[model samples]
Target: MSRLNRSRSFLWLAGTVGVTLLGSLIPLTTNNRFYYYDDTQAGAFGIWFEIGTKLSAGEWPLFSDTAWGAGNYAAEGQWGIWNPLVLLIGWLASTSPNIVVFSTVLKITCLCVLAAGTFLLAGSYKARPEWAAIAGVAVTLTGFTVYIDAASWVTGLMVFSLLPLAWFGLRRMAFAGGNPILALVAAYVLITIGYVHGTLMLAVLFLGLFAEAWLTARSRNVMFRLLLAGMVCGFIALAVYLPGVLTAPVTARTGGIANSGFLTPDLTGLATVWVPGSLPQITGWWGGFAPVPLLYVAWFLPVLAIVDYGRMWAGGKELAAIGVFGLLSLGLTLAPSDLGPLRFPIRLMPYVSLALLLGAAVLLSRYRVAVLSRGRLAVTAAIVISGLYLAWSQYPSIRMAAAFGLLSVAGIGGLYFLLFSPRAAPRLKSPAATAAGVILVSLVVAAGQHAAFKASPLPDYRMPDTPQAYSRQLPGAEGGTFVVGDPTKLGSQIWNETLASNAWYLNSAQVQNLYSPIMFAKYAEDLCITSHGWTCSSAGRKLFETDPATGKVLADLLSLDTVQILRDPAATSDDIFRDGPPAGWHESSRSADAVVWMRDRPLLNTGQVVWASDGTRLSLVSENSQEVVLRVDGLDGGSGKAVLSRLAWPGYSAQGASLAAPLRGYLVELDIPANSVGKSITLRFEPPAWPAVVGSIIIAIVVSLGWSLGELVLLRRRRPDKAWADRAMAEPVKAVSPQ
Candidate 1:
């Protein structure tokens, strides 16, 4: 391609990306609101807000006492604090006046990335830029990705968006003799996102690409470079996941496999894959059916009826590889509800959709077909009718099925005329015109889908209030605040003009009602807390009870200065306050929302040490999330133990005292030896094996960058020779074609 053509291609790709991004924002624009549903509001936003606040305040948020069982942010891993881009986004959202807007912006930006990457990947497969753009837009607005991942699971969106770029890089290096640096960098960033499902998806992608390379080229150098990339990614994975792996034993994240069928796709759903708004019978958080187009890949996918299958068959080995990969993805998506550590087979839908879209792009780009014949049009109609029938069989919503069928038929007709109609003007069949038509139709479909999704009653479309609203409603507590209530009940109060949700990280107060998928088992059990940090009604009694080992009440051990119990108007009697406030506790306030109890005397030592053995004295010298310093006395003659409020996650170390077995097998315990008792002790926490993990990551990055740069220089040096250019152009394009 000439330089001008390259420029034009870039411009077209940019235009496609912009269109996809605008289409993605339709949910926000059409609804006049952000995507603040379920996990998006309660989990991801709050964590991002906290990350930004802590980093801005010059604190590394490795642990948070406010979060209690969910305090070990590093161990949780999904926070993505290790990724620089994630940190930047978190900081930006935290500082933004309206965080909801920022969250929306971040998601749209990721959507654009997905679009751009998909476009480039299709181009690498030799698809025409226009066809590539169609694939990009289609995949960007695919059902599961847009509705489920982008709307509710931002981290999943982040990971899914990068897959195409990673594929493009790997394809270039393995087949085109392009530099491997792109592949290395993309893989590194993908793994660093710290979502296990995404990591698993990347692993599958790597294996698929590697297998394709080996079967087609069998080049030793290609195999070596691919292996090298995989190894580097492996090291980065270690750096990102080691802490979480070590901490998993104590967490609620015990992996198991089951076939309860949650988030499992029915094979029958495939019949309605092209119907944008057909809600298939699939079990999800919304219950019996998905409100969004869980199975919709693209409106144009059905246009494959008019494409030349013989030509695609003759296209070559790459197409077969893509078919195999798609099949593999389908198998996984239909796998059990839980597959080892990776749960929710439906999360793999994005990959499956990508495969199908890529295949369509390749077939369409490679084979120029005659004008749509009557027979082909008949076949298309039949396909659409069959899909509607299958969907209606399961869902029995005739109106919905009819609407989706009509839309699919209209989309197919429009696409057919744009690509192959002989009656159309010459320019109408040009690549740019074809791209414009696809983008326009895609945007319309996306907008319609967004409107439908907004109108759907399945999703709780309640928007969370601003950070300032939360801070104003719940004043900062001197010590941490312990919330005692049912999470389900409290969650419903989010939009009820109250600060009683799991988004506790939004406020200045150290509210304990935070959400985490993994919690320290013992801490959760002891406090009657669940994974989301919501405590049972009996949690109030548990809080005032004395710990046998620490000889201190749970409230004092937690250093809680305030307690908020959800006010249940229907209850016959109050549980904690019924007996009159426990000693040293008094009712400070009451409202329709909650009853607040204040501590009469706060602990003098605000650090982790809640109680110490006799003859051992400790005073808080300094403390932060990751480190603590304490002055010790009266332990010079005998051994003693001090129980810490901190959970015993894997990486804490004491300089002057050795770590004792956890008190009650949960809290951090320090054993002070006779020799080191008088010395001031410094305790610090880091992910175990930090030195090696950090070193390996840094070295892998530097070496990969250096290798890639060197290869680029060598290629450039050889590029100027006429023979080299001719030879390169003449080489059989063994590049993988999309299946």
Candidate 2:
């Protein structure tokens, strides 16, 4: 019997890994292994992969002269500088800046983790293996997962794994007893909060869990313990999360949505949460909605939710507390529209999806397995037929509906056979059937999801490694800032811009390319003004097309002297192409892929003493994931301002002159002495942990660690003769034998 249980558990784990991998085949194996549509994948992660190269070189991976609006602000917290996952990937891909490969690996790995975590949590709650495994699928292949997985916003998928792990820990402490795994996982979720949604959604989920603990505590003391656990988690989160929290307000994302109340999610759209590719203007994806009814995706989900809700309310307050938790989470989705702080409303769907699926699984496990009574069979068939009819009626394309209907019937039939029927000489039961049901469901969902995701046409973006590079040099090699332009706007084939820009960077040059990193608000605006003359964008990026005059003015400001445009009409207006190079510049060269122009003199040299008139030279010294350094030479003699090209942050140090405040709000300048002339200077970046600048982060870290350590000690001392973890999780209530 024990061996059978062990086998069942192993199969459940393997089944999860198998299903996640099956779902990932289309995205992973495709030529477009990574989606670079929009900046989230290609341009944004393009910069991140560059930073990973710096990490490989063992440099502090924060500030850069080549990007961040050409020079201003550290490579801010928008892309998760401190996340463990980010750092780990950064470390691994340091020597290899292959964004596509790393992103695919991360996506596949996270999906597996999400499934395994959900399955373990379900088992910890004493769910039947089949139901628990289904819950894992429900969590992994939802609308939210379908949309975000394998996209540029892959970090959000990482949270799917963390959420389940955290829940498992909380459940163990609540229902069984205290254990190390729970606190550890909970702490990890809190730490990773910044990696996804800037900590907003994760924080909201934490609050919901807090409410659950309050309502469901077996005793008041237990409630205190739970609250303390939450406090501990928050403390550590703030310790790590403060820098991002402090800086995010200054970015373009600071403002609240105007008339946010109108952002309510459509009821129909909400119902089809199982579907993917809604109207981009509507559900924000290009594909049509799913063929099946949304609620049909969770057939047993709603049935079991009601059952669980009733059970919790009538007999088990502890279980009922979970019901309330789900309700609160669903309710929080509504607040995003009315409340000012939240951004996208769809962000709340993952939690609501989890609640619905988990509630269903718990009910399925704790109750009697449904018998194939004649009436029940008839009812199930009627429901399935009605669902097919509804699918056909709702979707515009009847063929898709028909196809979905067929799949549904097959899936339902397979599930029924696995759970209820014994084909040969009928025995009391077969546990192996549970594994079979998991496989059936996984196959159907994986196929449907792949089709739904592929329903909309993907952007036609493509780029080969070591992509096209221009053979010409811009005039600003001294200042290391030039402008590059491409014909296509921010659409597919955007890599023309990145490829040329990479050519510039590798050939020891920098560009004001159409690509923008997650930038400072002022820098974003400056680039917008420079690139488009008058167009403004609130998103933290701007295009790089410019009116002739605007181009010159922007060049002056950004310390640029050369402008290269790929031979394309949209980027090059006839004004300059019909005549020649604009005033103050002359055409230097032209080629099929590029045209280069030159300015007579340099812009503000990176290491200008007195902000000008000094024959000073600055060269990049060494850079890696942890730090960046620049060498300044031949300051011929002066107690003048030494202006550097890198942006000014609070965390800069220099070898020759004392580090002073920023010259403007954008560039870094230092006060040096006349005697410092002819002596080489090295400037380095080392930003302080701003969130804990006053030692609060340290204090919080110490207190939280101490509190957690104390709790562990107390638990051990109290249960000296027994292993609490073994009792709490390892000995999860065994599945009840069929009567």
Candidate 3:
């Protein structure tokens, strides 16, 4: 590479890292006691921890009865087991001393990835390296990304961070005759991240890029290649979602589009896009209004008045593509609250912000002049005043702060223009000086925004003592633990004070509490469970009922050894244990926060096969999350049933016995025929359509590789001709600038 290109690469890397670290300092400092909050603490960390633990132990955890409602890891889909980066993160975090510190580092690394991806995307549009870097920093620190995604929705953040890279790859292949391999690989990784919303955005991005290529290049070969690439990506997506699709009929996620208006942004929220700290009028997690500027894109977006729009409109294919993407994302962000399986329209804000900032970068790179004209200056002033007025009108209580934010924007714009425009001294006009000014201004604005947003919206009531605090406090149960309580009532106290939500996963304790988007509908309905895993008040009583098939209580049938009940305002006088422990169970421990119940005679065989019928007898040989081995003995001349304490996910099959109907509508049941005596049986659970899913993935890879090889051969043949070289050099650069 040339010295200039190498320097630009270095600046992009250093500026992204520097800005991410600096912008993240305020949240870290404000809550030094804990960096993760809300869903991140309650769900993501524990789920990832379990996934990492299983992976580290050389296990591919596809189904886990230990997790109860959320045990179908592959069917749940967002575990990201197929992605290598996610595997590495999970593996490293599994051994870390402090999960909070590890999680904090992981989030920061995601920010850096997001920033670098944005920079590359803008560079693909022929934006100067400095302008691209500014766009990167601005988009990286956008309110939804930092406060909403990084703070709580970590999987969403992981998926969002890769979007820009995916776009960059598609743009290169479709417009610049770049290698098709990179585009295929980028799309594969993005889809395998396993977040449905990101996958949807990728589809929209592909459409936008393809449309631009068709309209501007009009190359049949390019269009064919792009279409073929998209088809390959579609096959890859099928592989990722096959398990979920097969299991959807039995899962809680089966639903159509329904908008609850939750997390939906009002149209007026767009006015605060330029105000750094101004909150928008939207229905956010905090209700009524967002505490952070969830819609803020960049403070300097309004100051690109020096751009020559007429020239850009005539020749800028990149600008037109960005406009298309921005409008599509805007429409989606204002769409119904729920669109199919994806919810919360505000989740698309980061993409909208990215498109807007990248558009600004493309325009400035193509048409920014050395001096601001009088007419452009008047337009810039008008934009600034209008932005301030709209922001004040939406949030009248923060007029002073909005005015101050507008002044900051003006000051930064003035400084940037002075350094790059003709009015500045010649020394300040050098590329090095201008690049440094852009980096400095971008970092300053990001830091200011972080400061204004304050800490994450975390309750200060509870703090985790250590990564193993939950495991240390809660007793391990060989046969499962069932937590009965309401997490919404406990607030942040649920993290450290009780085994609620996914806290049981941290303890490696098999518990009924589950944190997953998809769950077994029958299992949830039987216990009156909510999607978040909170059971009804009467759930404890339901556990004591005797199973007619095996004459074992429901607790024994499910192999539960521990029961924890949270003490809250709603605890009534006639609680489940008010009359004392039922037969075969005793009160093991009690505290101000909760009461723990333990089975007096824990089931002797604590393996997968928990219960057997009168004529069937089984001995546990070996067991794991996915498979179980049992030796059958007493099924001599009569048919009987054997029940395994596993949720009846659609994939389970038995080798020696027929798959029986679900026992009590949930546990995996096996029918032992008359001749089945003294034989070993193996029960396994694989994703239902494993063969088809694997075939789809293999086909996609083969097709992509074949296409890439064909392109390589064509390129090699073209490289030997002098005429081809001259034409290539003379052709107007379609994707990136020559500089």
For lDDT, the strongest prediction is 1
TM-scores for all predictions: 0.91, 0.75, 0.89
Per-residue error for 198 in candidate 3, Å, reads 1.3
All predictions: root-mean-square deviation over Cα? Answer: 3.8, 6.5, 4.1
Candidate with top TM-score is: 1
Q: lDDT (CA) for every model shown? A: 0.74, 0.50, 0.74
Steric collisions counted per model: 1, 12, 0
lDDT (C-alpha) at residue 6 in model 2: 65
TM-score of 3: 0.89
Report the Cα lDDT for residue 244, model 1.
80
lDDT of 1 by residue, 1-739 (tens): 5666556777867887888877877777666444555677767877787788889989776776546677777778888766877788778878878756777788888889998888888777767777788888888888888777877778888888988888887777767667777778777777777878778877787778777776677888778878878887888888888888887888877778888888899888877788777778888767888767888888777777877677666655666557767888889899999765567898889989999998888777766466567887898888877877887887787777676667777777777877666688998877788888877777787777776676322344364547666665445355777777753553455333334334667766666667778888877887877765667788888888888776788788777788877644445565663555778877776666667787788653444788888878888788977788888867744878888777787888999888988876777888887755557888888877778767878878887888888887798665423232122222212332322
Q: What is the lDDT of residue 332 in candidate 1?
A: 89
Give per-residue CA lDDT, model 2, range 1-739, as digits (tens). Answer: 2566566577767876787677656544443544433333434444445556566667655555555442322324434454455666655643444545655666778777777777777676556666767787667666556544335455556665677767666656644556535555455544543443424544554555556556655467566656766665565566454553455543443556454433345554454443322221132334344322222234343233113234344544445534655676666655545343345554556667777777666666665344555555676666555544544445555666556556555665655665567673243244446545555554565565555544213232444443123222343344434443443444434344334322233334555442433345565454442321112221111222342422324344355665554443443243233335656667776645555566676554333332432454545566532244545555554454555545554455777767666544555666665665456566666545643532544554565567657768887557532333232223433543332
Candidate 1 off by > 4 Å: 307-311, 368-382, 417-427, 455-465, 487-502, 568-574, 577-579, 604-606, 635-637, 674-677, 680-682, 720-739
Weakest 10 consecutive residues of candidate 2 by summed lDDT: 532-541
